[model samples]
Target: MPNPIKVVLVEDSAVAREIMQRLLDSSPEVDVVGTAQDGIQGLDVIAQTKPDVICVDLQMPRMDGLEFTQKVMSDYPRPILVVSNAVHPSDVDNIFNLMSAGALDFFPKPTSGTATDYEKLKSALVTKIKVLASKAK
Candidate 1:
């Protein structure tokens, strides 16, 4: 098998961050290289880790995913996956902006805490990561 895909997760919510890390780590194909609480810190972590793919939240302090995506595309130029729970109408526009800014995909945060829900989300997240990591920057 090929080397596991390196990943950095950036989420403002501590609970969400931990949940995402656990879910990603459960898979053998992905490696959680680093994590951060916000986009500013995310940039620093990304620079240090040099991950193959990035998972970021849309809302956060200091910098949001949109700005972070823009900065990463300009400086590092890697495939990014936006993992967010922004369900509001306006937030859809923000997600689109992120795509235009260079983010390759978006995954909605899970709502329920059931094992089934987690399992489904985990599969989706891992699959998205694999596809994004394989994408050419």
Candidate 2:
């Protein structure tokens, strides 16, 4: 066995943040080192945790994920995985811009559906985290 993959989550929605935290914590291979409700707080948490990967949401107050990603790329340079509920064209375009800004991957926000849907999203996130962590290290 090895050290669990360290992760920091940056999301604005309290319910979404809590759900993600719980799901990630359920995996023994991952460790939720820290969490923040916005990008400003996220920067502090990421600095403190020094996580291998960051799960971030695009729409946040104070500092959205795009700006955060830019700052992180310029100053910190780390693997960032975007999880957003972007439905509009402009929003989706911003998500792509986030990738250009330095995010490693992007995924649509998981909807509150059936258990199977939830499980599938969880698995996808976990898999992406593992891959990103490995590549980051």
Candidate 3:
């Protein structure tokens, strides 16, 4: 990417937010312009930053990714990527719901442990963001 893709992250866990930010920031192709703890704050950040793609958690305080995705699509119309570990349902209802709510993609929240884990997280996250960024354009 000639210019880094502007991104907004909406996650309730401070640790998860920080980890994801670091992962995204590791790639020169991605620029995490802003982050919010929850969807209400996410709305404000989204409005201010006008990111090219948004990364959101499915389960959050104040508002969940489903509602957040709905609002963002109607109000701002950006590509949304729901990165969450919320796929416990046998049928993967969370994934379907978020997709219907207008998320462009979904990924399991990356787990950090080994060097390979970090490398995999970096590649998958940046690749997803790159793909979603194109959808927004």
Candidate 4:
């Protein structure tokens, strides 16, 4: 088998972070190499892990996802996937801004707690990660 896709997760919410971690853990194609609760720490984690892809939340403390994406694009330049709650209009702007800043793709975080929703999210997440990793290769 090939090496799993290494990923660094940056999200401020502990519950959201845990949820993403669990979802990624269940995917055999992805690997959670590191996780950070804020963008400041996320930078350090990214540098240390040198992951193949990054999963980030937009609204975070210390530094937001847009800032993080700009910094990473300028420095690391890896595949960044925004896994955020894009509920508000401002969040839509943030998502677009993050893309312009060099995020490859994004998935709006699921609002519902249904298992089917979670499964779809998981499938999309894994598929995106694989595609991004393939492009990187």
Q: Pick the winner on TM-score between candidates 1 and 4.
A: 1
What lDDT tens digits, residue by residue, belong to model 3 across residues 11-105? 99988888899999999999999999999999999999999999999899899899999999999999999888885445477778877889888
Which candidate would rank higher by lDDT, 1 or 4?
1
- Select the stronger candidate by TM-score from 1 and 2: 1
Clashes of each: 0, 0, 0, 0
lDDT of candidate 4 over 1-137, digit per residue (tens): 88899999999988888888888999888999999998999999999999999999888889999899999999898999888876244666776787789998887765447898789888888999899888787
In model 4, state the lDDT of residue 21: 88
What value of lDDT does candidate 4 attain over all alpha carbons? 0.87
Model 4 off-target regions past 4 Å?
87-92
Best by TM-score: 3
- CA lDDT, every model vs. true structure: 0.90, 0.87, 0.90, 0.87
State the lDDT of candidate 2 residue by residue for 1-137, as single tens digits: 99999999999999889889877898999999999999999999988889999999989999999999998888778899988887334666775688789998887776577888888878988999999998887
The reply for model 3, stretches above 4 Å from the true place, is: 88-90
What is the TM-score of each predicted model, taking all chains together?
0.93, 0.92, 0.95, 0.90
Against the true structure, candidate 1 has what lDDT?
Answer: 0.90
